[model samples]
Target: MEEELVQQSSSTWPPPPPFWQAFTPENIARIEKSRQQQAEREGVEDASNVRLHDLPRELRALQPPLEPADGEWRVFGDKYRLVDELPKLEDMQIRRLFPNPEDRDRDGKHFDRALILKRLAKSLLLNFLELMGLFAINPEAAQDKITDIRDMFINFHHLINEYRPHQARESLISMMQAQLDRTRAETNAIRDAKDKTERIMEGLGSLKFGDELVGDSTPQKDPWATQREVWASALADIS
Candidate 1:
């Protein structure tokens, strides 16, 4: 039986390596080095095949020039500060609260988030207005503009959603404050009602309506005395 098992193990298509040899540092290093080399070769090939012009205009702008600038570009030097110069939007200025990190460059250059939002807003409004005009002229032609308007609105909302956490926190604070105010108002109302009831009770206590009965000489008859006597007589008779 042992001989048969040995033959079966030896006849396996690919024998597993000895456990001690499999986990050796040298073997692991060799495997890792080969993988790194393969990755490098693939990266080089990918880089060589991709051209600058093939990239989108927005992506191309992110690429640095091959040559360094001759002079520093900071015209304002130490005088320049990273301050938000954009005009505040309605009540919640999310752009100011949570500015996009990618929008600002190391050179202190920053694209205006306010301007981007304004442009999107303007585009959405104008497109909707145009669609309305088109609908008035010809409803069939307006359908195409509606898609454009919808896309613009979606883009605008998508940008707004980026600062959703800040908006959500603000909304939560406002709601909590409203609830606290309402609770306080209700408490005050209850307190006022209690005070009013206490005052009414005090006023009723001082009235002279029942005072005259305290001093009256008239004796009131006990209605339940006769019923108790009858019950006692019936019990006697039963006994």
Candidate 2:
């Protein structure tokens, strides 16, 4: 009994108070205040994802500032040089399907962006022959994908004809940039959620793992070795 008392007394002096027991009115009030503040902050931040027309001009879109266009011409022109190279989008296919240049342009812009590429290539080829006289540059040698098309005419090239962006295209680009910004934001949110889950798992791991926990894991009572005979014997003894 004295040993027990000594052990109990030695355990801790003036035992630390419990961190939580039941919610008090003061605690509830503080929690409510914190929740309200968090909600307000979240509401303010959530507005960044939403575009409000009436908001200040600076606050309207959450995209990086687009650089002002220089008057120089830009062309997505590989589409011009590669049209003849494709077995599927052959000269026969283009002539049969879209005989008229106007029809070709309309269909390319409407149905598929590739047709637009074909039209641009033809225009560029004709313009080149008209200006520079015929050289043996085969359009077939040109190759690049949709994004690569952006850089196809970036450097000085006599074959490439530059295209100027119109007011409507600029507006469309602004909208596209906004959409890209939103997509990036959503991607970041998903990544943050994944990180949060990992952090929570790490926190749980920190609590569940320590020298004390490692020591506690040492096997004391185990049931794995007991078999059917042991159970039968135990039952018999009980009876």
Candidate 3:
């Protein structure tokens, strides 16, 4: 058999460079110089596009001072005045009282509720009046107007239900009753007109128009009978 030889590579290899080699002063200086150049370029670009007149006062005050700082003291010649700081006691007390931000928001909510109530009150009153046929010039047309008024009241009540204000509910109930009263009055007036018309027709039916050709055909018993009948009918209808 031929002689066999085994070759082994050495376990020790040359040590890697030191950690600080890559971060040498020369490399750090090169990086800083590049950063400064980039910053200067950006500054020049911004200055070219920016309008001095549009710049805020605070930003305009960012110019370098005429003299540099000497040790720890600043050598700027700007007018500097020392003003006493506001006392923190009141601020602390306020913060303690209103720990939650919602307290301020509650005031806003209350004002909004007041506004909503005012608007609802106005709308309810207007609707009530319209329903009662108070706008009708002729009292004879009051009966037909009652239905319209009733429907409007129903709609108003539904609207009030949605608002659901316990405090104002009583006031609304009183207003609704007033509307009912007005509607009742209108219905009575319509009945009175009908009764008057009926009385005139009745008196006419009893008289003979042709027989009175030579005499007075007009009935001369009581001049206020028709008026009295109208009043009685109106009272009965209202009751």
Worst ten in a row by lDDT for model 3? 1-10
Model 1 stretches with alpha carbons more than 4 Å out: 1-100, 103-114, 123-157, 210-239
Q: What is the C-alpha lDDT of each candidate?
A: 0.62, 0.48, 0.52
**What TM-score goes with each of the models?**
0.32, 0.22, 0.21
| Residue 67 of model 1, lDDT score | 30
Question: Which digits, one per residue and each the tens of the lDDT, describe model 2 over residues 1-239?
Answer: 99877886777453443533434565555444544565576675443343223433333232233333542332332223322232222332322222333464654554444454566576555554543332245434433232233222321121121222344587999999999999999999999999999999877765734334433556554445578669889999999
Q: Give lDDT tens digits, candidate 3, residues 1-239.
A: 12221222222443343543555566556544544565576675433232233323333333233332432332233333244232232342322211133454765644344454465567557656664655566666666556544544444444344345664787889999999999999999999999999999877767756434324657656768999999999999999
Q: Considering summed lDDT, which 10 consecutive residues are worst modelled in model 2?
A: 155-164
Query: How many steric clashes between backbone atoms does each model show?
Result: 0, 1, 1
Q: How close to the true structure is residue 102 of candidate 2, measured as C-alpha lDDT? A: 44
The C-alpha stretches of model 3 lying farther than 4 A from their native spots are 1-164, 212-239
Report model 1's TM-score to 2 decimal places: 0.32
Could you tell which candidate, 1 or 3, scores higher by lDDT?
1
Clash pairs, model 3 backbone = 131-149
The candidate, 2 or 3, that scores higher on lDDT is 3
What is the clash count of model 2? 1
- lDDT for model 1, please: 0.62
